[model samples]
Target: MAYWLMKSEPYEYSWSQLVADGRNVWTGVRNYQAANNLRAMQVGDRAFFYHSNEGREIVGVMEIAKTAYPDPTDETARFVAVEVTPLMAAVTPVTLAAVKADPRLVDFSLVRQSRLSVAPVRDGEWAMLCEMAGISA
Candidate 1:
């Protein structure tokens, strides 16, 4: 299965919110590239739940529960969304600073495209981050 990373501002929709809700459609992506990433996702794909802005850290893991569908927020139907279920919370949130400092993660999408909200994650990178968070990859 493909691995990915999805970012949400803590104040807007945190990892805790996702855990509480169990599952929900991940929507509101306007960027073409991020939209493409969403469309590329499939049910059962795993993703890192990242808290952007001030919290710049990966707090949990999520698995895609539903494949891409027309986004409800887009009247033009230009975007797509996929439902995700919380898989597990990290023992210690993996911070962005830590990610940037790691040589093994220099090629990571999170570092290369810092502004992208959704991006692909290589298996090696995923394993490294999970290791940093003290969780089994």
Candidate 2:
């Protein structure tokens, strides 16, 4: 299964909100690369839920509940979205600072491409991140 990291602003949609809502449609991607990442997601693929802007940390995990579909939020129909269900909250949220300091994650997309909202995670990076968050991968 492919691993991914998806970012959401805390105020817009926090990890707690996802847990409460059970699941949500991950949409509104405008960037072509990020949009492609959304389209690449398949059902059952796991993702890290990163709280961007305010917290800048990976707070939880989620599973892709549905494959990509035309985004209802986009009138142009150029974008797509996927349904994601909360898997488990991280025992310890992995901060950006911690990630930056870790040599193992030096080449990660999160570090290489800070502006990307959705980024692919390599297997080794995923394993290390799960360990950092105190979660079983």
Candidate 3:
């Protein structure tokens, strides 16, 4: 299965919110690149639930529950969204500071393309991150 990372602002939608909701449509992506990433996602692919902006950490794991579909929020009908289900919350949220400090994660998209809200995660990096979050890879 492919691995991915998706960011959401804590104030807007926190990890706790996702857990409470059980499942949700991951929409509102305006960026072209982020939209492309969303389109590329498939059902059952694992993803890191990142708390962006103030929180700035990977707070949980999620799985894509639905493939790309036309976004209802888009009046132009140009974008798409996927549905995601919560898998697990991290024992210790992996902060951006922690990621930047680790040499093993230096080349990660989270570092190289910090502005990206949706990005691909390599298998090795995914394994290491799972370890950091106190979960089995």
Q: Model 2 TM-score?
A: 0.99
Query: Can you write out model 3's per-residue Cα lDDT over 32-135, one digit (the tens) per residue?
Result: 99999999888899999999998799999999999999999999999999999999999989999999999999999999999999999999999999999997
Single out the weakest 10-residue window by summed lDDT for candidate 3: 128-137
Q: Residue 47 in candidate 3 has what lDDT? A: 98
Q: What is the lDDT of residue 7 in candidate 2?
A: 97
TM-score of every candidate relative to the true structure: 0.98, 0.99, 0.98
Task: List, residue by residue over 1-137, the lDDT tens digit for candidate 2.
Answer: 99999999999989999999999999888899999999898899999999999999999999999999999999999999999999999999999999999998999999999999999999999999999999999
Per-model lDDT = 0.94, 0.95, 0.94
- Which lDDT tens digits does candidate 1 get at residues 67-127? 9999999999889989999999999999999999999999999999999999999999989
* Clash total of candidate 1: 0
